[model samples]
Target: MKGFMLMFMGIGHLYEAFAGVHILQYMYGCSRDDETEQTERFGQLGYNGENFLEYDMKTLTWKSRKQQAHFMQDEWNSDISRLDFWKNYFSQTCIDCLKKQVDKGKSTLMKTVPPSVSLLQKTPFSPVTCHATGFYPRGVTVFWQKDGQDPHEDVENGETLPNDDGTFQKSTHLTVTPEEWKNNKYQCVVQVTGIKEVFIKVLTESEIQTNWEDPAPNIILIIGGVVALLLVVVGVVVGVVIWKKKSKKGFVPASTSDTDSDNSGKGVQKT
Candidate 1:
């Protein structure tokens, strides 16, 4: 990023030397990864160029650089001449200068790393934030969209912030109602030049967290049933058995009946 700023400064200085008017152009801009990009330019004519002007790419408006106010210019011819000069300078001279710098081993092409994207809803009333970080080239776009269209209201946009690792970061938030949240029409879209495809995330139940109970009780019940059955089988196979005896009560003998019959025969003979 420092190298990039210096290069622009060098271009402005070289143009001033060539034009002999001390033309000063201060360009400032930033991007998140490569998705969304913006640039601001404030140019001057001489040392006391406090009345300088600038162009804002996002709003498509021109304003005074020092005062940060918009004004109409009646000097169309003068503006046109300066515009033409800059066009030629960037087209031919800028390219040649950059080539020379590369030949002299003063320019480099750094590899860009893709950003990490996250969609978060902190609270019920709070907005859903789409955050991206750790990207290169400082050019990226993060937006809240519905059905492929940009929402006009209930949206908050954040500035592109720098990270410690030299990558860029940005975030955007959308305040949605419960019906809109579950409608499946809301999505967060991200785009970066280094990445092949756009990154998109949606709000769903699968993204939320929930609590569940432990299964220890079910496991204990299963073990107890098995042990009880084993104890029953062992008792039937190895246990001792006891029997009770019955006593003799009454009996009839054959000698008693023969004696009674002999007594009856002796009584008849005496008669």
Candidate 2:
């Protein structure tokens, strides 16, 4: 049977308004003959909110819950590049439980081709960011893969920036007609120099805009602001200097002493 799989982790107990969420899904888990049956089986095996009881309607396997929670809006993480422990749970469908303890299997998918540009939400056209820092793509290749079937298999429009260490890490920004972004699905793929390809989907503007977790404003704005301020300061300084130069010599520098050379004791000998 054919079906999708997922594992969640790092549910840092926080308010529904603000919190980090993640989910892990792998295709290298198992093979199937019937896609619909597989989907049904997996859906039935899905974690139930009533204390972790995944119900398999076919075989009637009431798998006991082991610390599972209700699948909410922000529950399962969509990023495939997660390496954290709790976020690396094996979530697939099979007769027997498929739980493996691989040291670094958290983002197995991301370890593949380049990250894919996500389906950007288009209320406001957002950017798509991608960083290639995985095992497979140590420096393999980088690009954007739209559909999940293939990496070098879709439309790509943007540039790739290389990392400081000669490796490549790139970001792509595209403004979609408010209608298309929200309605379309996109992804960013990273191809390691020699390894495999790792791909990630572009989710939101925030994801791409702040992909670097950057604390600084955009390069263009920051540069522009600094340049403008410098220009203003220069203008003021120039105005002052021009005024000073253009003005008649000030009656001489101001002094504590009176203008009279008399011994007023203001402390200045009459040269």
Candidate 3:
């Protein structure tokens, strides 16, 4: 199934409580057997949510179709609209685009790489995540299991979302208590179409690493060490400068009269 809409809005034009030019909408659907379905081609001319033209591939006819040319009110007029012509045009265009996309897809092989599974315990609850990425043909199933049995009622299944690298990823979360952490067994299981085997892993605390663990303490320690070294160097320099200044101004004790008398007595006795 495919759909396309092209709207042309004149300046200051308003429709459906919005200002815009609504024009040229197209949609198409195709399958392995084209005969099995109807309403394959549908389009709307205005923004009023009314079907402009719809074609049934089974009956190959147009029913209750309306057409609106540029800046014109919608009216049911198939005589001048030529529904068959537009139907063939949209069908051909869609089929050609589909073929091109299919060819491009065929060039790349479809494969499934098992997800990297991890278990996390965050205070009140524990969550197990299975990141299955870089796989083609996006259909995948990821779920959780308790002990050796199927998923329990308490399990929460997350939606399968696309990744930036054109692959798909999904996570299944299960809440656990502290008691459950020590006593219960939990695992995350992954299954994809291309791979025949199912991937399974038991949840473990060792497998989970918190990305938010702070490095501020280590950084502060490094800064403190640097500051302490600078302080020690400054203290040593200041002490050495003061000691040198005191040594330059030497302390000489005053010579007293007693020393002179002793010297004179010794000289006179020798004479």
Highest TM-score against the true fold, candidate: 3
Cα lDDT tens digits, model 2, 1-271, are 1233333232222233454443322122332233354422332222222334343344333344454433421243332343122123222333233323221353553343443333333234344334444233344444554444434422344445554643344444444444554575555555444343345555444564332333355777889999999999999999999898868676777456555544465676667
TM-score per model over all chains: 0.44, 0.25, 0.52
> Taking the tens digit of each residue's C-alpha lDDT, what string does model 1 give over 1-271?
2232113431244235546655344542222222222222333232234445554334333445454223332242247775565555444554455445545653324456788887766655567778888877577888877887888899898988999977889999888876787875777788875566788876664552224334578678778877887887776554532111122333546566777788757846552
User: Each candidate: how many clashes?
Assistant: 10, 45, 2
Q: What tens-digit string does per-residue lDDT give for candidate 3 at 87-170? A: 665567655554565556644533345555555544334454555555545777877777878766767778878878777777
Q: Write out the backbone clash pairs for model 1.
A: 32-140, 33-139, 33-140, 34-139, 34-140, 35-140, 35-141, 35-191, 36-140, 36-141
Off by over 4 Å in 1: 1-45, 50-97, 100-110, 194-196, 208-271
By summed lDDT, which 10 consecutive residues of candidate 3 come out lowest? 1-10
Question: CA lDDT, every prediction?
Answer: 0.59, 0.42, 0.59
Query: In candidate 3, how many Å is residue 149 off?
Result: 3.4
**Sort by TM-score, top down from the best:** 3, 1, 2
Write down the worst ten-residue block by lDDT for model 1.
31-40
